[model samples]
Target: MPNYAESHRDLDSYISARVPVIGMRTIEQQRALRLVREVATHPRRSSMPFWIYTRATGLRDLRTNAPLQEDRSLTGAMEYAASQFTARPNATLVLVDPDDLEGDTPLTRHIAEVARLAGNNSGSIILLTDTPVWSGLQRLGMSLQLDLPDADEMYGVLAGFLTDHQGIIPIAWSEDDARRAAETLLGVTEAEAVNLMATVAAKGSVDKDDVPALAQSKDRIFSDLTGLVKVQLKDADYTVGGLSNLRDWLRRKNQLMQADLRHTEIRPPRGVLLVGVPGCGKSLSAKAIAAEWKLPLYRLDMGAIHGKYLGESEGRFREALETADRVAPCVLWIDEIEKGLAGRDDGTGVPQRIIGQFLFWLQESRSRAFVVATANDVRSLPPELLRKGRFDELFFVDLPDAQDRKEIIQLYYRRYVKAEPDPDQLARLVDLSEGFAGSDIEGALHDVGAEVYLGGGAEALRPSFVMDTFANTIPLSRNNPEQIEEIRAWGRERAVAAGRTAGATTQGAPGPARRIVFMED
Candidate 1:
């Protein structure tokens, strides 16, 4: 339904009329050039135009098939274009140097002079750069912005690519899928996409199923080392007990995902902040959700992100976000988020600035990265981060209650134990492990096995051996009652209790009831 070819035609018309300057922000450079070519050959246009193009990075000289010696200097290139094309046509193409003109540079003076020369010759100039440094040029009456390839244009480009190698379509491609793929290619060049498609097609047929994988691989190649990793969401029905309210919240999120498919325009949920006791399955939930959604999972290691250089940290952060966008509809796991932000107070303000940038990106980004940030200490985080809009929901993971503990014990025993254990024995073990988190219960089970091994055989050690380990291990709740109570009190009203009834009390008072919905059979 969307027509990209028509959009390209409209853009071409606007540029050919001596528009002075045009800004094109798109992934496909060839498509941009094609639009320019269309405008150049418009029937309504009387004469051909000579144009001068400027790039921050040196441009390859098409004439010599080599880098031009003069290409390094914008002033010289403009002067040469002005002299050479003075008598030729309606528009003169001059390529300007971005570095020579960027931030507080004398390039502004040269641009003005070049603009005046172009006006005298009845031609126009175009400037291209990675970053649009247009403020300087805008003041000199040189500000014409062009739209990037719309849905229709993208479809044409993709169709052309597919047709060139694979021939006619065996089955009609879904326009929605094609448009999404095009949008994912945003900020990527046409040459890059063509080359990537060529590589993919070389392996096998470039069909619909291959699109998702190809899209992910292309992003991995271009966006630097720290790209997004795809993770599949877990089966909700198989998830162990506790946060009843959290389950309800996930149902709403699923509903949103479905709604987005229908409308073709959906803003992704902001993210989630999971804070509570350590080893309480906070990190596990992240992986479970990924498996549940049938997406890829990538864990963000803060240690890997911190760079020694002045600007490297920011660069790394940007690259990470870009990678996530390129490999859309994936999860990014940030474990111990508080620890990552803990190093923020170095006094140099670099870390603070980075945090601010991350927050801004989280709020404004249109990427499909569903962030799942886990933290054990909430006090270490800044107050601004706790604000409502930063995360879709803040869920507290407390120590497992009796029911939850029983479920966890069953899950682990079913996974690791060779023989089926008695249900009564499992209930007794769960009762003994009261006040203990899931991790502690697992550790206790490990201790039981160790005792049996040390005694030379399973028959040598009685059930009392396991019970002794459970009794001796002081739970974190007993060792640090004040801290645990404080966290529970703080998260009582504001946070949803995970792995329990929606209306279950974490401390003493009743909260709002959460509606539980299973995402799997």
Candidate 2:
């Protein structure tokens, strides 16, 4: 499929060559009509006789809306088209949305017959449809697919649509606002765009604040699409205690991610990979990114992609990725991606093939989909996936340090204990949770909250009870010291630390620095 400009040129070339049948396939019927009119009214092709037919409009002059016939049925329209081809040379007939042309049926064969007649007279048959033409009819001429408007072309389409409502609606949009709205409304059709604007205008005023409504409207069209789960974001879900380094990086990238980069050679920032110890904030970071950036979040469920039949697994994975692309300017969270792309195959090679397909899409896709993939086990990832440039950066999420634990404790303390944490008590709690991950701190706080709930209210909450909750629980680092140490060692060596640099480096620093220099001139 070509862009609008390319499609126009190809349509013009095909019509000039007297391609007896031109199947213009598109979901946008109005846009297709406008394109046909533009081509028909061209100076070089201005003299050619052009007519259009719809069930409601019957047959009419395409350039002017003059009725050519009183017949209102498709049968009647095709009957009239057949006679016109033989009677008039260089006559073009546009059949708008004719049904039953998907296979070589009676109607398709009839269309093929009319196409042959048109060919003899240097005329053409234009089928304006969103369906596939029968092979018999398609053989008579060529077909071109008109994809949805790109951002550049969409600006014009949106501006034109909005111009019609100027006097009636109080539109508070400038050129920049319109461009922003147009970019957000990229995936929907021109008709849908107009309808959405109309929907917004129906609310009594059209202002800059209503621009986001356009995106909301566009999203409604694809609300029920398959292969993705729409994650409902909660403010609490993004409490995100630490990872200042990751947070700062994401904030900077968000600025570039949402900007207009079509004219510039610089590509939008792709995404990041967070791999580290379990129960750290890697998973929550996905939610935080979406909340921070104000974009929709979709969790790609790899567990759902596996199928009982051959090829079904690959098909599902592809569908999931395609769905993500369709809903652009969104965050795609792949939690524990190692589990999904591990290089293990049962007698069949479905898993291997899926990995290849995934990498190709991730590398080539220019869509505004920011992928946030997390993994607990860095060792399980395929080598190709970890190569440079796969993601914008690779971040390692270590366990919450003393500073991070203090913040996490204070955050959940406010939520659960209904009070600000005492700074001195917080210091003690932080020390107690030295090896605790963000999740471990959250879990401990959650227990404190639960205990307060069961024991009447926050008034009855004992500081010792909260202290005991932190003291009694054995964190993951304590349960499997070897495994946690191994993960921390790998992260320290290979990945960018997600927490602040000081918290990241001060942990387990090599003891006793030595000086080797003596008297080198």
Candidate 3:
């Protein structure tokens, strides 16, 4: 149940201002009813009489907790309440689980009419719902969404639980540990917070060791959501190479990313957009970030979220975002974002509406699910998405430079060949792999290792064979020269270089006279 004290002031202000029809959208029906009773009886609000109507209980006096048995049916209760409004002009009537009365049926019409009459007097009709599915009544009422507890409120909840169960349960938690636990449990409801803490206390102690368990609990809370895959990081030792600028930026945000440091004034990093050549570690960086931060990674598959049924796509998308919020201080990896947003301008208008929803979440979401969106084609992305505030920064990951290629070659050699190539061999391999992507270099190394197996001897693998293999493979830069040029042109002007050094690093760099046309294919 929600805390009545937390929301009573807002409810009182709404009634005092004479907002005739109020929609209290919350799952905590009992808590909302309690708040309505408290607000109605307060002296500041003129101590208006309040009535609560439910299908089971019918119409009842909120102050005395007495039922009007004669007015038990829905029609009789509403009609009786409407009659009382003429005599007790400033009264309030609340109805719970009113989802059925949201249509244009006679009952709904009567409810709307009752709302208008209640407004003429100083009375109001408050509708309470767990799932606010009624669009019709929403227009007639001012909907007030009671959100889950914020950090401070969650802290109070945790502290109160600890105090209540201290001697009885033999619980163990310091002030610091309690604060940290509250931060981890930010998105759950007040009831859920108490239940989760109670579960932890049932073990006879609540310590810092239980924080990971809390995160896993949050994961279970969101297990029903589709298109969001929880990435298991155990034994995953991958890292993105040669993006010094990106690496440094992430390192600087290391402290702020710690959710336990809620007392700090610095705002945590939202995330970055990685737009550049395919197979250039754009997607890899998203995974590597979670690994580097030791945070959970969730891949939001935008393609998988699109449903054929009407409004299904939007519902799934909203659920996915909500799940991300519930499991915060985590990384949200969206790979190949351009592919999802490519046909957004088409006829159905579904894609455009989805884009609008996505934009709203991106700008307004207060959750700590850092968004790391990777895009292969920038020109297809909406211009609004490319604006400055959409992401913390837009990084352009061009092909590995000469030095990056060298480091990558050495890395692959050590991984597959199990030996570092001699300096002369390393230099030759780097020079031969110019314009090769990280994937291309890694692929060539895999091929070189395969030859050793087929030759039936580890000694069959040589540095020359590795160099020859890479030299023969034509890179994406050469095969798609026109597209690569266009991508480079867009990145150079609008995005920060991911590599440490800037300027032309690839051969046959486009000149000022070269005309680069945007092409999807």
Candidate 4:
């Protein structure tokens, strides 16, 4: 990155010289004016340098001395400049155009013509375009670029914006927030910033709490550039019980935020991967992680991102990543990730390329957006994704054991009945749910409830309702026993079990046993 002082000085020097052609790559009108002034006041190499200013909309006559008329083209602008400097003979000609000259057909061609016109006049011409336009103008020979706002500039801009507001006072923004926002909005022009602030202020009293929303709104406003949508975690309640060890790990992560405030390079905690049987709360744990982190959750639906148009999928993924960075200190949940990015045998490399890009961003991103990716089959995932440093931990969610099943039953009973179910009835239900996952157990409860409602009322229903539900349902362990055992055996050596076992604690105490739960098929 060029130093701020160097960039500013370079631009200043470029503007001050009576060069035949000068190009400025920036979006701010004020900065462009500053550059023009610097060049106009510099020691003149010639007695007169004609100034030709061109814009899509003609310059306003602030003096109210004449009616306003649009120049519409660079050729017309040059004529106007000649008229303005007729008496000076060797006057400088400054051409100012709000539209990027490269994109404007006639204007670009006129640039060469204008240069010829100022050949012996000791005049200068300046072209100004927004950042987007500048990228296309790279081939147009040496030009000056104004540096984006740094941390200090952000502070000044934010402070000034706040001071000018007459509504509720804005709270002091943290350095981290300011730095992150500034970097994410780097190429944004001053006018864009002002517009963002105005939109934010219009909704509510601008404060610290409102910053996230403002940032989200800005991301949405630029949705074409940042394709991301807000996501909500619906299963936060699942992490409350039977996952003590995992919860403790999460708690420790939260503590790290306060450990050393002075350290500026603190890495945001990389997230975890939950892999195991279907409905074993892998997805639920992702929701819980977001809740624990106290951040907004965004579910990156790969299906939504995949497009029929060539290269569109990759573009969408990049946009999503950029948006995630823009709205930092958030969570990105990529559910069923293995299936989402699986490459086909066909020669199309789009999936591979898109996944590669995603992983690269995951490893190098400086944003605080935590990524929680869940998958059912590890064998299908690319090995590079599972390597150390990609995610902090990988957990295996096996079938919930007997003890976990008991807890699941109690939790659901209390939630649905507002009281404990009969202990004997609950015991029987747990016994029958041996190899079921949390989701299966919930389904069983739903079946029992449906039976009770059909039979007339709660009085007519008994433990038999649950027994019948169990009898009617088929356990997944029976059909996929080999797969289940393979997962468990593989997890024994590699992953932390997400279940309650013989060595597990029941009083919500954290232990070494992988937290697990059993469900009815």
Which candidate leads in TM-score? 2
Can you tell me which runs of candidate 2 are displaced by over 4 Å? Answer: 43-47, 66-71, 161-174, 202-214, 308-310, 344-347, 501-521
Q: Write the per-residue lDDT of candidate 3 for residues 1-521, one digit (tens) a residue.
A: 34445566677778878787888877666656666777777776556788888888888987787987666787887888788876778888888886465456676778888888888888888888776535665677676866667778788988898888878875556787777677778777777777887788778876667765675565555565567998776542366668888889878775566546565654557788999888888888888888777667899989888999989988888888888887887889988888776686578777787778778888877667889999988988888888887788899998889888888787777776666778987887787777788998888887876787687655666555766777676778777878987887888888999987654657743322232222222
- Model 1 worst lDDT run, 10 consecutive residues: 508-517
Give a tens-digit lDDT track for model 4, residues 1-521.
Answer: 34345666765565455455666666466766665555555555334343434454454332221323466565565666655444344455444544445564565655655554553454555666654333233333347766555445654666577668755745455655544445434445555666777776776666566555544544444434245556645553435446555667778876553233234666767677878777777777767766665566678888888888889989888988877765555677889998878884537788898878988887887656778788887778887887887887877777777877788778766655445778888888877776677887877777666666687766666656567676555556655666766666666667776554422212321123232333534
Residue pairs in clash, model 3:
none
Clashes of 2: 0
CA lDDT, every model vs. true structure: 0.62, 0.83, 0.77, 0.62
So what's the TM-score on candidate 2? Answer: 0.89
lDDT of 2 by residue, 219-261 (tens): 6777775668889888698768888899889988987876777
Q: How many times do residue backbones clash in model 3? A: 0
Task: Estimate the TM-score of every prediction.
Answer: 0.71, 0.89, 0.74, 0.73
Q: What is the C-alpha RMSD of each candidate to the true structure, in Å?
A: 8.2, 7.3, 7.2, 6.7
**Which of candidates 1 and 2 is the stronger one according to TM-score?**
2
